[model samples]
Target: MSQGDAQIDFYPATQAPIFRENWPRMRSHAIVPRSKEGWIDPVISEWSLEGAAWEDFHPHAEYNYVLEGELHISVDGEEVVLQVGDSATVPAGKLGRYWAPKFARMLTVYGPNPDGEESTDFKYEEL
Candidate 1:
């Protein structure tokens, strides 16, 4: 497959190099990397972590799927648990946190690149 294809396939148990080697430290990694101007494009992200408290605001909505294990996600004070095979979407403008008492792996899709000119206001909040 040529680079920059609109779609890419991955093997089972395959962790993209960027994520396989740094999942612990980075907790997350995005594949089909996007250029700074590729805001209209979507990116798939793989995340593995024990626990994390995050406050993020984006101009585009985010959709998440639990690849393995489970995640207790809280969005704007609403709590939900996503087990393997489950999915959820956090709309743009919402703030949330994700916690996994045990190690968990998940895949996420953002409607738009999180770091594009259209989303210049995207930032992690202090809360």
Candidate 2:
């Protein structure tokens, strides 16, 4: 799908392509590219590692839907735990932290596509 074209994209039962990876933390699969500025990108992601944390300032709003396991997230000081079938949206420009006790699989969409760059980007601290 390109910019300014009205069309519907289809994905079969095949696997999605992995777009980014950071060992023992998270991996992102690209479902659709954020072809333009201020556009969200659809992605599938996996979070692993017990007690691993991701602390960062989001450049865009992140919408997540838990697919497999549990995800514990902290936005600024509030804590929220999401399980399978739960969905949440982390607003833009917030300091956030995410940790998984064991593992989690999720469908995520980033408004303005956080990885809308020539290569994958990483902007978080591990604790």
Query: What is the per-residue lDDT of model 2 for residues 5-48, given as tens digits with 9 covering 90 to 100?
Result: 96868654434333245544555555654554435545444334
Residue 63 miss distance in model 2 (angstroms): 0.8
Best by lDDT: 1
Candidate 2's displacement at residue 23, Å, is: 2.2
What are the clashing pairs of model 2? Answer: none
Worst 10 residues of 1 by lDDT: 118-127
- Candidate 1 lDDT, 45-70, residue by residue in tens: 78765543334566678788999887
